[model samples]
Target chain A: MDSIMRVTVYIKIKPEVLDPQGTAIARALSDLGFAGINKVRQGKIIEIDLDKTNAIKAVSDTESMCERLLANTIIEDYSISIGE
Target chain B: MDSIMRVTVYIKIKPEVLDPQGTAIARALSDLGFAGINKVRQGKIIEIDLDKTNAIKAVSDTESMCERLLANTIIEDYSISIGE
Candidate 1:
């Protein structure tokens, strides 16, 4: 059955790679008088809808999507979550 | 002990709001020959480090950060996850 399924992908920059944007957020929070703040890193979250009911296949396809476009393997790391 | 703790914040656009970036990703995937794609939505993943050992206090402080700056409550919704 070609039913709809949902998959979520979380992408984050590599630890070694500098995250200036995230650093900026940390500074901004500090400027706003927020205390106890240390470091802040930001990433992208993508929720995809696929016309496939099989959970296993959905995850497989999503991994391909990540390897292809969803993430930059050179400087980013990605994790995939499927089903509820 | 003032050890560092990590808290993750997930911010997503309200369902009613349009997400062109997500839409573009879906279309791009289709053009690249990947099929069965229906829809896609994008969000933000913010990982915050705080100099607090208490998990409870960390979440509370992060929530304030969300309400104050991280999210634009008008068109977005955010959730927080703490510790492992």
Candidate 2:
């Protein structure tokens, strides 16, 4: 038997940093014919693997991780969703 | 007038590598009472700013940036989203 879980974390800028990457993406989309896609912002999605059963515990733990190490709380905000 | 755009890039694990960070998050969630949250994965979110109106171009440029510099496409995957 295998006891494991998977979760995804989303973290992004707090609307402060300059988004040059986003601008570049938006440009690419236009070249690709993705109309109406005026602006482009990029965020991070982290997938984690763990050995556990309690899902709630996972989210809270991840959130704290985001606050402490994963993300810069002063300039970035993060959200977590767990599953599998 | 600001001829600029914002894009968010989400970079995450490729589901093959073991995520120690995710495991730690799961453990933390259990302590916080976030029931059902079994796993937790952490990722990165990058916000970029650009000077342009053509959104399509922005996306393409950003994608290339991810492929070239912004993200490591080997053990990780990335997605882009656009907005004001």
Candidate 3:
């Protein structure tokens, strides 16, 4: 088929991992006087366009990429989505 | 009615604003020997837990938060989703 495929990966710190950035944002919101903010978690979104045709291959490829460079598996978790 | 609402905010760089970080990511992916990576863009996902029950109020509050601090609207654009 050889149609260009689009992938989106979301990477976030594991719940067990402390996210200073998220904490900072929560604090900043509190400072700004915005009430009712119980928690804030920050994550990264990576959108990629691949010159591949197969959706399954694209998902596998994206997962490998996340394991290798996109995410730190020890403290971060990543999920890959294809064609969206 | 006071129920916890989860709000998700996605902030992305304005298309006109050059994304050096995204460029670096693409370059890194290329160096890692993954082929067919044509374009890459990086964005931020902020998950917020608010003690608000009204969906409309939560959305409006989130939009204001993005305008005030969560996003740099000058060079970035943000989208907010509630109860998801």
**For each candidate, what TM-score against the reference?**
0.94, 0.55, 0.94
**Model 3 CA deviation exceeding 4 Å by range:** A1-3
lDDT of 1: 0.91
For model 2 chain B, where is the 10-residue window of minimal lDDT? B32-41
lDDT per residue, candidate 1, A1-84, as tens digits? Answer: 547888999999999999998999999999999887888999999999988767888888899999999999999999999853
> In terms of DockQ, which candidate is stronger, 1 or 2?
1
lDDT of 3: 0.91
The regions of model 2 sitting more than 4 angstroms off are: A1-84, B31-34
Writing each residue's lDDT as its tens digit, candidate 3 over A1-84 gives: 646788999999998999899999999999999999998999999989899768888888899999999999999999888876
- Quick one: ranking by TM-score, best first? 3, 1, 2
Worst 10 residues of 3 chain B by lDDT: B1-10
Clashes of 3: 0
Chain B global fold similarity (TM-score) for predicted model 2 against the true chain B: 0.81
How much is the TM-score of the A chain of model 1?
A: 0.91
Q: List the residue pairs that clash in candidate 1.
A: none
Instruction: Evaluate residue A76 in candidate 1 and report its C-alpha lDDT on the 0 to 100 scale.
Output: 99
